[model samples]
Each structure stands twice: as C-alpha cells, then as structure tokens.
Target: MGFRVRSPQDFWGGIVLIIIALIAIWASRDLAGMRGFAFGPGTAPRLFAGLLAFCGALVALVGLLQDGPKIGAYAIRGPLFIVAAILTFALAVRPLGLVFATYVTFLVSIMASKEMRLIESVIAAAAMTAFCVGLFTYLLGLPFQLWPPFMY
Candidate 1:
C-alpha cells in the first residue's frame, strides 16, 4: 500500500481525536453498562466515544487520500494564549460576570494571532461578547449575570 499523508494537520488531529476518544472510553469503563432492557450510566458515554473514534478514523483516511497544504511550523504562542483565555474566562465568569469575562477572553485569545489588528480585534470581540451574552441569557433562557455583582 503506497500511502502518503497529504494533510499532516488533519492526520495528526485525527490521531489526537482517536487518542482522546480512547481515553474517554477507558475512563468510563468502570461505570455501569447496559443491563437487560435499560441503558446504564456508561452507555451513552461509551457510545459517543466509539462514534468519535469512527469520525477520527474517517478524518485520517481523508488525510491519506486528499492533497492539502503542507504543515507549517508549530507556534506555542497560539495554544498558550488560547489556554490562558479559557482559564481567564473560567476564573472570571462568576466574579466579573458574562459581559466582562467574555470580552476579556476574546482579547486574550486574539493576542495569539500576530496579524490581528488591535482596533479590529476590539470591535470583533465586542460583537462576539454581545452575541454570546444574548444567546446564552435571552435565547437559551439561561440565567447568566451580565455584569458585575457590585453593579446591581
């Protein structure tokens, strides 16, 4: 079989997805599974994990067949800042509220890209923050504090 990886990113991404799915399956193994006519705690989780593995395999196969862009040099700044943004949002959401936390997170994550302009990023972040707040609080009907507790 003459197999060549056409999309290194997709190939590696699929491999990671498979590994994550395997880990999820392993972690849920101790939970109760199917018994007789009813589903158990682990049934849905294991089923989803199997589906994820299947999708990952499909992605890997596509990478092997289709031609795509070559892999570029890895950049730690992007991942690092993105993780930081996530952490910031998690830590600040309760204290700073949804509006502030979302904006801050967007700003932090935007810093990961070198080509992003400050003005454009700020505008985009504001728009995204408004959308998220509206979607979560109004559309989804979830109770999310929009502003700081002290503001009320």
Candidate 2:
C-alpha cells in the first residue's frame, strides 16, 4: 500500500512551519551563537529555530498518524497586506521615523482583516506607537527619532 497523508492540512501546515524554521536557522547561522560561558546575539534565534523545527516535525508526524480535513485554497488578501505592511515599515522607518511608519504599518495591516474597525485600529495603533517609542527610547535607552528630521 502507498503511504498517504492522513491529515493534509496539518501536514501542509507542519511543512510550512519547517520551511520557516529552516529559513530562520539559515538566516541566523552567520551571527554569533554561544561564546564560551556567555550567550551571543544569535543564541536565542538558533535555539528557537531548532525548537520550531522539532515542533514542526512533531506536527507533521501527527498529520501522518491522524485523520484531518483537506487543505483549502490559500487566501491572498491577508498575506498581501501583511507583506505590504512589512515593506511599508522597512521603507518608511528611516525617512518617516518610527511614529508615522508604525502608524501607517498598522493601518495597512488592518486593511487585511474583514472585521477591522477604523476607530479602534487608530486608537490601538496610536497606543502601540507610543508604547514602542517609550520602550525603545526611555527603557531601552536606544536613540530613535520620534519624528522626521525635516519636522524637527
């Protein structure tokens, strides 16, 4: 008898996770890991990536053992907007600063959701932007521009 995937969705999901984990691991490989007794910058990412790979394997194993629903068609809207938001943040963060970039990113990401409320999104985005500003600036002591250079 041919081996068949009992749970197509879980199997596919697990495969996707594994792919992501592998990408993460590959991405972090160049960074420093354990430096003798001290943990380096890449330690957490490498560890987490390994853990994710293990979890993905387990999920795929479960998929092989258990029955599941068939995989459905992929949605484009959410992923498209999410990618757009990431690109927006990356492009906007430098010239626009954190506040405007973050707010715009949030707004763009919210457009992907069907149940998004404009007022709530605005309020939430504002609060998150303020929190990030405070956290990165005051607590972390990282120098970040709150507004564009032209504005100041």
Candidate 3:
C-alpha cells in the first residue's frame, strides 16, 4: 500500500546482497597482479565487485536509518533446485560445451517456469538455443564446443 517494500524481508535481502558483494570484492582483490589496461580480465570484476559492495553497504545503511522490515517475512523456495541446476551447468560445461549447456539450461528454466507446456517450452528453448549458437559460433567465430565430436 506504500511506496516501499511491504516487509523486513527486503532489509535482510540487502544484507544477503552485501555479503555476496563482499565475497566478490574479496575474490577480485586476489587478481590485483593483472595490471593491464581496460581489457584486463580482472579490471571488470574489480570494478563491478567494488560497485556492488558499495551499493550493498549503502542499502544496509539506509535500512538501518529507516524503520525497515525484518528478514523472517521473506519466502525462499526452490533454493536447492537452483543450486543444483547451477552445479549441474558448471559440471556439464566442458564436456557438453556451451551450446549444449545453453540448450539444457534454457529447457530447464522453461520447464521450471511452471507456466508453459512441456512441448511448447522445448520448442521455444530449441529455437533460442539455435539462434544463440548460430550467432556466437558461426557469426562471431567464438570458439566453444556445443557437443563432443561423436555426439555432433
């Protein structure tokens, strides 16, 4: 009813975000040795992580200053599923390659959406996968394996 989050869940959410941001910033700090130009791999993460951490801390401060809600009101569902899916994707990437992993992730996401029919979702995922694979592999010449030699 108000122009604000309805519960304390959001404040705690800010805390979680701050933790994630701190972790990213900490991880990136180890890459300080890569002192390259804007093209360095560490450059973007360092900047991004620092920004995230700063924003997260600011959110926490604002929550503290205001009569913010608490974390207990939030609902967390299917966290295990999300974590498992992420782990699965990481494990599958090298062997199944980018294209296949993309397809699989798309399909899993669509099915997990709980709003689409299985066949319809599969078709849509396949189309999107084809489009992405075509763009990255054929058009941009980004070298990534879609499937192993025998599977392709």
Candidate 4:
C-alpha cells in the first residue's frame, strides 16, 4: 500500500517548519561561536534551530503514523490580522512609541478572535501597554520612547 498522510495539514506544517529551521541554521552558521566554552551569538540560534527541526520531524512522523482527520479549509482571518498587527507595531513603534504601539498591536490582534469583546480588548491592550512599559522601560532600562515626540 502506498504511504498515506494521516494529517496533510500537520505534515505540511512540519515541512514548512523544517524548511524554516534549516534556513535559520544555515544563516546562523557563519555567526561566531568561538572555540572551547565560548558560546557566541550563533549558539542559541543553532540550538533552537536544531530543536525546531527535530520537533518538525517528530510532527511529520506522527502525521505519517496516525490516522487523522482530513485537512480542512484554511482560515485567513486570524493569520492576516496577526500579520497586520505585527506590521502595525513595526511601523508605529518608531513614531508612536512603545506604549501606543503596544496598545495598537494588542487591539489589532484581538480582532482576529471571533469572540472578541471590545471591553476585553481594551483592557488587554491597556494591560499589555503597561506590562511592556514596565518590563522594557523600567525593569530593563530600555531607552524606548514612551510617547510621540510632540507629546514630549
């Protein structure tokens, strides 16, 4: 009997993850990892990449071995919203600053959920903004601007 993929989506997901992991490993290969006990920038990336690759392989193997449901229709809304949120954050962070950008990102991402409530989203946004400000600004002492230039 020919090999049948039990979960086409999971198998494909594994393949994509493996490909990404391979690319990461290749890109990080040239980065410095000095000899003997000296771990450089590449070390963590390589370790993570290796782990990702292994996990991807395991997922693929599981997909192959088990009988699973057929792949269903792909949903674009969640992914699109998440990408938009990330892009919004990247674009807004410099001009709008951390707190505003974080709030916007949280708000944008919340739209991806079908059961999203406005009040909950607002609360989440505020909490995320405060947490990010506390972590990056106060605890880590990062020099991120908290507000727009005009507000300063």
Candidate 5:
C-alpha cells in the first residue's frame, strides 16, 4: 500500500511545530541551564521547546493513525496579509511610533477579510491604536513614542 498523510492539517501542523521547536532549542543552546538544581536562563525555554516537539510528534502520530479528509486548496491572502501586518508593525514601530504603527498594522490585516468594511476597519484600527498606546505607553509606562521622532 502506498503511504499517504491521513490528515494533511495535522501532519503539516506537526511539521511546522517541530521545526519551530527545533529552532527554539538551537537558538537557546548558548543560554545557561540548571546549576545545582537552580533553574537558569535556558531552563524554561528548553523545557517549552521539548514540550512543543513532543506535542508535534503526538499530533503527527494521531494524523498517521486516523483516516481523514483530503487536503484542500491553500489560501494565501490571509497568511500574506497577516505576515505583512506583522512586518509593517515591526518596521514602523521605531520610526512611526506605536500608535501609527498599530493603526497601520490593523488596517493592513483587515484586508485579509473578504467582508472587510472600510468604516469598520478604520474604527478597528483607531481602537487598536488607542488601546496599544494606552496600554504600552500610559498604563505600562513603556516610554514608547506616540508619534514619529521628527514630530516631537
């Protein structure tokens, strides 16, 4: 019998999780671990990475055991928009500041929705911007600039 992935979602999800866990584990290799039973900087991250890898393997096993539906067409728009939104937020945060960056990110992410409404998106962006500014700057006292440096 030809081997096949019973559940495409579970199999692919497991693979992604495993990859992320491996990367995390590798990246945290330099961090110090337990010293005389006291947890060090790498302890928690290593533990979490191990757990992620275990969960991914479990998911893959379950996928292999179960007979599932065929894989459907992948939707690129949602993922693309979400990734773009995240990148935009990262790039804009230092230059445009938190409020504008958050607003722009929210606006860009809304484009992923098929039923996106302009007014709703704008309102959502504004609300998100306000919430981020208030939480990070005012409430948490993060010292993030509300506007661009040139605007100061």
Candidate 6:
C-alpha cells in the first residue's frame, strides 16, 4: 500500500463507491422514509442513504490518511490455456446448452487446477457436472435448456 493519492482523481475509487451508494439511495428513496418513522415510502431510502454516506466518508477518510508511494502493480497472469478452457464452457453453453456448459466448465476447472491428473480431472469433472445439472435443472427448475434447442 505504497501509493499516495494526491488528488481526488488519484482517489477515484471512493468517488465511484459514493456515486453508486447515492444512486442506490435515490432509487430506493420512494420506497419508504426513515427507519424510526416507517410511515412513508421515503423512509427506507433516507435511512439507507445516510448509512451509505457514512460508510463512504469513512473509506475516503482512511484513504486520505494512508501512506504514499504505491509499491506493487496488480495483474492477473494465469495460463492462456486455462483461460481458454474456461471460455470453452461459455462458448459451448449457447450451442450445446446447460448440460454441455456444466460439463465443459467442470472440465476446464479441473484442468485449471495446478496439480490435477488427467484421469482424476475427467472423473471429478463428470461428477461435478452431474451434480450441477441435477441441482439447477431438476431441483431448482431454472428453465435453462438441458440440450441444444433450435433458435430462431
């Protein structure tokens, strides 16, 4: 945490959070009034907004008091094959549907694991995919396609 924020621009994260909090407050404003007087629709938003402003201000204050000279730059540098494997599930889902996506995601996730063996990967992927299909399709009845369906 070496980075020093000199201006609001440098500390733009808090601004974004504040804006989001404000919007949530505004959106929920008409629902109810303050918590103590729950008599009107404006109560809920006012109470929520007040809490949001409080937390946002607290975060901003902490940012201002922290040390300077940001040390490490953050990045995601996982293997390209790993990423491709994950994307494979997404690609398969539209054409192959939920059953395929679940199976592919399982396969990709197993391959993505650092120490996975090929045989174990296959078994684990199959088991996980089956469990997911059962839970989502049978138990939850989410209305997702189990097999590829004709699209117009």
Q: Work out the TM-score per prediction.
A: 0.54, 0.55, 0.52, 0.56, 0.59, 0.51
Clash number for each model: 0, 0, 2, 0, 0, 14
Candidate 1: where are CA atoms >4 Å away? 1-73
Against the reference, the lDDT scores of all candidates come to: 0.92, 0.93, 0.71, 0.90, 0.90, 0.70
lDDT of 3: 0.71
Model 3, TM vs. native: 0.52
Better of 2 and 3 by lDDT: 2
What TM-score quantifies how close candidate 5 is to the native fold?
Answer: 0.59
Give the TM-score comparing model 1 with the true structure, all chains together: 0.54
Per-residue lDDT of model 1, residues 48-116, tens digit only: 999999999988777777887777898899999999999999999999999999999999999888887
Say what the RMSD of model 5 is.
Answer: 4.6
Off by over 4 Å in 4: 1-71
Better of 3 and 4 by lDDT: 4
Higher-scoring candidate on TM-score, 1 or 6: 1
| lDDT winner between candidates 4 and 6 | 4
Off by over 4 Å in 3: 1-66, 70-85, 149-152
Ranking by lDDT: 2, 1, 4, 5, 3, 6
lDDT for predicted candidate 5 compared with the true structure:
0.90
**Residue 14 Cα positional deviation in candidate 4, in Å, after optimal superposition:** 12
Ranking by TM-score: 5, 4, 2, 1, 3, 6
Best by TM-score: 5
Candidate 3, number of clashes: 2
User: 5-122, model 4: which lDDT tens digit per residue?
Assistant: 9888778778889999999999998998756888788889999999999999988888888877777887999999999999999999999988889999999999998999999889
